[model samples]
Target: MTHRIQLAGHRWVRLVTRLAVVLLLATGGLVTNLASTAQPAYAHAYLVETSPVDGEVLASPPPAVRLRFNEAVSFNERSIQLLDTNAEKLAIGTPGHVDGKANTAQVSLPTDLTEGTYVLAWRVTSADSHVVSGALTFSIGHPSATAAPVEQDAHRAVVVVDAVGRALAFLGMALALGGALFVAVLWPAGRSDRRGRRIVWSGFVVLAAGTVVVLLVQGPYAAGTSLAGVFDPDLLGAALSTRLGHALLTRLVIVLALGVAFGLAVRHGSPPATTGTATTATAGAAGAARRIVLPAVATVGAVALPLTWTLTDHAQTGVQTWLAVPATSLHLLAMALWLGGLITLAACVLVPAGRRETSRAITLEPALPRFSGLAQVCFAVIAATGVYLSWRQVGTWAALGATDFGRLLLGKLAVVLAVVGLAAGARRFVRRRGREPLGVDAAPAAAVRRLRRSVVGEILLGVAVVSITAVLVNTAPARTSYAPPVHTTVPVPAAAAESAAGLQDASIEVNIEPARSGSNVADIYLTGPDGSLVAVPEVSGQLESPDRDVPALPVTVTAAEPGHYVANSMSIPFPGEWVLRLDIRVSDFDETPVRVRFTAR
Candidate 1:
């Protein structure tokens, strides 16, 4: 009978995991319908407006170039650069704020520039500590046939290493928070479990190491330099000055404090609190230290540790930040407690007690039920916060399929579902065993083995979820990252009726692809009431930034098909309200203007 139950349970577990994977692949429609409608108000920064639009042909150099972003951003002297057509670096003014606006950066241009096409490369740190960089071109004369290539993104290896460091930190955090909770609080023999103590100690070391790695690599990551810059004093100094650096530093300190508390909890959990004081007189001292000192420090450190992450990460920047921060911290705490506790439980209790291999009897009396209760609470917290955070980060239904962040989230949910399935079985076992006359340890050997296998599966799935989450952390939130292009058609101006015959019943159709920022191509089609292209004599274009307080920038519109006009290199200076005005010259004297208004992402 036990064998039959175990086999059926294993098969059921396998089926659930397979179903979870299939559901993940096809869950787009289901998730969108179920997703909450709350959208984040703010996110990462992108170039909103520039003094001179990208790809504009300027007769003379502008005195100063200003940049504006949709959100607050910070930059240093190294944030802006001028590169000539030949890829030679040129000196530019130090980047600073314009009129005390944190989102705007201004740098004086050198009057000596003789540019065929010069690339202005700018890098800035957003509130979330991610560095966004891009390059735009403005020609002094006509657009050059060939210009130097610009690499806007950070080095691939640097990004990968940074991600690895983050994964390690997350893993270490789980172990430190959850392992310590289980060994010191949940399991009765946790204090004396040699293997368990070692695991907790290893967690501290790994967490600290990962934090140090991220701290060092952050210099290169932000500066757009190679790995060699990791040790550069200036780069390191700049990194330390940012909010992310401060958070990492605080995290390290908290890790140290927490490590000390964990050490004391296990060492003096049943020992003299202090070193070398085992006497009865000092027993009172030990009791006070154990009962008062350890718990105080651990509680504070655990609470503060997640704050370091919440205060600098995605949670700190978006809408209802006050709420997001607390929710994210709770999410992290629940994850740490659940994952770390499960790993510790499986290694120290389930495996040994199931295999029945230990010389000392591994009792299941109170620890199993206690951990079961904690796990249940942790899962509840995880579900609540996960739903809220997912809604905040991924606002629209389209974004879930369009952005990298959204896809990663789906993958994470899949793995978590598999883990949840296994966890349900484990919880059921605990509940059923608790009601028996005999203790949980009296479970048949097959039943214990089945429980052990499910737990191992849960741990593996949990780690996979953590890995996906690490990548997700480095990606931009889908709410801000996904931007659809502009496509609209406006009726012909009334003046068109007096200007020409076909123009009376004709309309202008405009399409802009990937219209976020920088260079974009605008396609304009003149279609008559019959829905056919109507040729015009001449078309001249200008980009108007009326809302941004910038002068009109010339756009070079050229003929394509009969009535099709293409602004092959329409440069959008920023992501806000703008108009692409086309002056159509139908005859020698008659000219009418058609304006297409749109918003760039």
Candidate 2:
């Protein structure tokens, strides 16, 4: 009867191992390419247009300020602040979504506005639940009498804290998930190892603390406030109001449950007592009864934590959330399992051998091949999921090399490949060991040394991968860089013609397009006073808004058609009456400099 039960337990273990392998393979193949079809700009919210368009010099304040985005947004009135040059807040009504438009939000403005420049700074929740904010300045009559334009790095403190919190959370997840797996599967003897237990406990603590920090930082980040606001109850409350907040809160709850599972696993799976140790056989029997149960609970919590992470990040905002979220969550799990297990193996199994503990070290030899097999499965999943995410994130090959996010991703990939190569080396070492028993002897010790070095290399590379991943989460994906610029034609209402250098033979007719505070194409038509086309030696222009103390904007024109010269692109920095000085070279000997007033609104 005892032999039959032992055989059944062994079969159960084998079945569970087979199931895990099958799941990883099936998941990797099933959605390996799904993310490639997802939306290119996974989580970024773009401002399509704004009312009182950027740099508009309005004679009077508009009734309301409207901002349109390409994606649906969650409106927060308090997040939209109107400040004058002195940085004094203006009276603005609550913000609301525009009627019949899901992507437009507007805020009512006070009609009684004085003649001073005002800046509208806004933060909104994008469809993917990420916060996006920007500032636009428009003058009431003249530029506001205030301090010099403050560099926008005003929220650097909060950004740093947010990034730190993200890194901690990611690191914590790796430890907790990986550490738990080590104790549960790869090294059951780890149950008795002090380092292994501490690793698991430390992982839980780190993850929990990181989650708290992230929750605290989210509110202030969304509010675009300084570091002090992290403690603001109101701001924290505002964070809790968003879907992201709920996801974070749920993660905390899940972590709490995860802690309980770890505790239960420890209590129910206490190691065999050493000679003279006070631990009882009864306790061990109890542990044996509930051994599978505690690990199962731990596995669920591990999976749940990654799910919450996916819900609040790019995966959630991705075009195919259904596929991306699960695939990404699985990817994270695979990483955690592979990395965490290796860490545990090194610290508990391999590192101890260096201290001359050959007996304990030999006990770990059986687990090495098992972990290698698992790692192979994990690496496959990582590669498959990574390919899908790369296609989704980087859209084009040019962007992969050109964009910051893509560059970071490339760096991460290079390091991962190195880690994989090391892992392969370790696997080769494991295979060469064959069925021969390992010991404290020279050959086995050397083999162990080689494997440990490779494992250590992998761990170091893993840290780099995680650090880069934290930064990647904060970066705008490469796909966003591919968006085409908005180009619109704005006809210059004035047909005002200016003649060059005492010569009425060639007059310059200048027209600016979509006269706004961005790149605009200038059409300079050279014509005779008789309304006939005329050609000039060369044509160039510059813009200066004297009222706003703006500098000269250089414009280089090229001949696109006969008698018609066009500025490839010129930037109009502010909304006002800009003097478009057209330098028309009528001849090598004589040049005509003509000035025309261009209203950029």
Say which candidate scores most in TM-score.
Answer: 1
Q: Best-fitting candidate, measured by lDDT? A: 1
Q: Weakest 10 consecutive residues, lDDT, candidate 1?
A: 29-38
List residue ranges in candidate 1 displaced over 4 A.
Answer: 1-41, 97-101, 141-143, 268-282, 352-357, 494-506, 527-540, 556-568, 584-591
Q: Local error of candidate 2 at 541, Å?
A: 9.7
In candidate 2, stretches whose alpha carbon ends up further than 4 angstroms from where it belongs are 1-42, 75-77, 85-87, 99-102, 141-151, 268-295, 352-362, 435-443, 483-601
Query: Each model's TM-score?
Result: 0.85, 0.72
Model 2 lDDT tens row, 1-601 = 4444444445444544444344343333223322332233347676766777666677888898888777667666576888877888878999888886757889999998888888888888775556777777777777665522533433887777777787778878888888877776677676666788898888778778877887898777777778888879988888887656766766776666676666655653234344332234333444454566555556666676786667666786746667888789988999988988888878777774447455544455456777888889999999999999888878888777767898999999999999999999987776766545552222465677777788999999998898888888877777764432233322222322232322354355666765645568878776665676667677777776657644465676799886788886675644456787777665566555677776664
lDDT tens per residue, model 1, 1-601: 4344444434433443343343332233222321222123266777767777676678898898888787777788988988887888888889999998878899998998775888889889887778889887788867677777888899988898898888889899999999999999999889988888988888888888888888899988887889998879998998988777877876776776677567656764242233332343345544565676567667667776787777677887777787988899999999999999999998888775435555778777788889899999999999999999999999888889888999999999989989889999999999999889886988888999899899999999998988898888778999888778789999888887667878777889999977766778999999999999999898999988777556687888999989999998887777788888999898899888888888887
What is the alpha-carbon lDDT for the whole of candidate 1? 0.81
Q: lDDT per model, in order?
A: 0.81, 0.70
Lowest lDDT block of 10, candidate 2: 488-497
